[model samples]
Structure formats: structure tokens, C-alpha cells
Target: MVEFTDIGDVPSAEVDRMRAVYQPLADSVRELVDATIRTEMDADTVAAVRAEIDAATARLRSRQIDGAFGVRYTTGGDSLAWGNPVIGVRNPIAPPLTIERDLEDARGRVFTDFHLGAAYEGPPGHVHGGVAALILDHVLGEVAAHADTPRFTGTITLRYLRTTRLGRLHAEAAITRTDGIKAYAVGHLADEDGVTVEAEGVFIQPRWARG
Candidate 1:
């Protein structure tokens, strides 16, 4: 990863306010995605809905940002990774995760709670295996960051233990070992029944951070 300076911070209240506005927008878009994929509407109805969607899309694009939204933080120590594609609150494809650190109890462990809706469907009733890997990679990478040993994901290997159902899911990761700048981590994703996927990864702390 290229070295970049921090973007500084915004007030927590401002961050919360922005989240309140955009989070609901993301939810609405997610609903649109789910409906688009699973709708049983007839041809005419589908056409009508597409027309409305196109209109809405045009309105939103009327004024647009030039590029992607990146992570930001506040001087008060509040950080928002809300623009992340996998877990970002403003992204419809995201699982919209709320991750927590278990720094005191498990040290390097991190856990995330999220839901997978119909938009993530694969194999009729289960989430796409690739989506599972995306979630794992983010959480496993965050595990290193939470431990104050941040790194970019070098490689990730996932074992789909079983089909992950379309519903509430939990994931957890912790650093298992380290060799030089490489941090090895392992984790799993589970639903109400049990774990459906397992993952292991090596994350590399940049040479800049090591110094």
C-alpha cells in the first residue's frame, strides 16, 4: 500500500449526523438491490420499476463526487471506516458491519456483527462464497489494526465449511502468530446454526510503520 498521511478529524457530532443521513440512504439502496434480484413482478411492472430507478439514479448523479470516499477520523479520536466497500455503511453491497475489539479479553481479537440479505444470495439460500471471503478479509485485517499492528492483507485463504445462510452473521479474528513484518491471523463466520466458513491470512505491515 502507498504511504499516505492522515486526513485529520471531524467532530463526533458531525460524524454522527452524517451517518444518520447516509446510513438510511444505504438501507434504501440495499432494499432496491434485494428487490431487483428477487422481485416476482411481471414484465410490465418490472419495466415500470426500472423507469423509476433510472429517474432516481439521474437525480443522484446530478451532483456527484469525483472519486471514492476514503476513511476519515476526528481530532477527538473518533474514526469512521464508513466508506469501506465491504463493511461501509454507505455501500449497499456491504454487510454494514459494526465491528468491536476484544483488546482486553483476547488482545488482538476482533468481532463483527452483521446481516446478509437476499442481495447476497448464492446457491438459492446461501451467501456467495466470495462475499464470505470479503467479510473475512476485512475483519482479519482489522484484527491487526486493533492490536496496533496494522498491515495490508498479503494473502488470505478461506475454507467454506458449509453454506452461510442469508441472515444475521458473526465473525471473529485474532492474530495467531507473527514473523518479521507478517502477521498471521485466523477466523470464522457463523450463523445461528454454527460456523460456515474459516479463514487464515497474512498481513504485512508497511516498511514505514515498522520504522
Candidate 2:
């Protein structure tokens, strides 16, 4: 069995090069997902496309490592969490989110310019509310995890301000306040028009969590 350790084991220069190569492939796969979900075709045509997609997925799966893509490190000093639900590099299910963290201000932001195909449509032509909430929760959690004070979500509340369209979108979060054991945060999801969903959350450090 090939066991891997920290990414720091990998040389920084090598990691950078690897990322540059892999990122484009990941982006292409994301586009494939969007196209698959939104394609409008007759029954026979759709079936043929599904078969092709299945074959392509199988080919990729043949080269994948078993289980989840856990945090991996190289012999140098590079690290990557390619299976992170919010920012995994190879996960087609998640939007390409290059999360930026402002440790000084305790803020997390992700700007996604991906399309939400029919699979994400809830109403006539709008993105699903639940999906929006999921993205907000993940973004807020990342913000709270900053300061090396990671906490799990204890509660989250979301308000749907407007219908989110299927095109490009932006999401941002910031720490509002922090008590001794609880961190309060607020986030917003917006599009070219304006804010669509606003969220507030309380994250708690578990009893055993080290500060």
C-alpha cells in the first residue's frame, strides 16, 4: 500500500507546477458537469450522452485512489486537501472555489463563476434554496475555522432575500462576534443583480476542542 504523509514533504516548486496542471483538468470536468445537467435533448440523445458520461467517469475512476482524497503532503513542505467538500481540487460536485482567508479580520470569501445547470434548478429557472444554504454553511464554517480556532456548526439560519439565478455568483462571510465558546458569523450570497441569500450561524468549539 502506498501511504502518503504531509504535503510539506513535497517541494514547493513541484507542488505549484502540479497544481497548475491539475487545476485546468478539474475546471474542465466542472464544465462537463454543468453541461451534462443543463443539456436539453430528446430521450435517445440523452441516453447516448449518459452512456458516454458513464464511460468517461469509469476511466477516471480507474486512476483514482481508494477512499476519500484526504489531506496529502509531499516530501517537501506542500499540502493539499483535494477532497475537501468546499474546495476539493478534483471534486466535480463542488464549484471551483478558491477560498481566500483574511486571518487578521476573520473573513472568508469564495468567488464562483460557474453555472448551475438543471440539476440545481429548484423553481422555474432559479437555483435551489437548499443548495444555496449548503454553500453558505460551508463558506461560513471556513471563516470560523480561521484564527486556528476551528469550530463546528451548532446552528445556522438563512434568509432568502431573492431568487438566485443559474449563472455566475459570489459568496462572502465574516466573523461577527465570538464569545468564549461560541463564534457568531454572517454571510451573503449574491449575483450580478444583488444579494440573494443572507445567513447567520453559531459555531461551537466542542468540549474536547483545543483552543
Top candidate (TM-score): 1
TM-score of each: 0.89, 0.78
lDDT of each: 0.83, 0.75
Residues 1-55, model 2: lDDT tens digits: 2234464555787777877887778878778767876678899998998899899
* Cα RMSD for candidates in order: 2.2, 4.0
Q: How big is the positional error of residue 12 in model 1, measured in Å on the Cα after superposition?
A: 1.1
Candidate 1 lDDT by residue in tens digits, 1-211: 4423355666778878988998999989988888788789899999998899899999999997667676655667765666687778888877688888885955478898888988788888899898898899999998866434569889999998899999999999998988888889999999999999999998998777785
**Candidate 1: stretches off by over 4 Å:** 1-9, 147-149
lDDT of 1 at 105: 58
Query: What alpha-carbon RMSD in Å does predicted model 1 have with respect to the real structure?
Result: 2.2
Which residue pairs in model 1 clash with each other?
Answer: 9-73, 9-74, 10-74
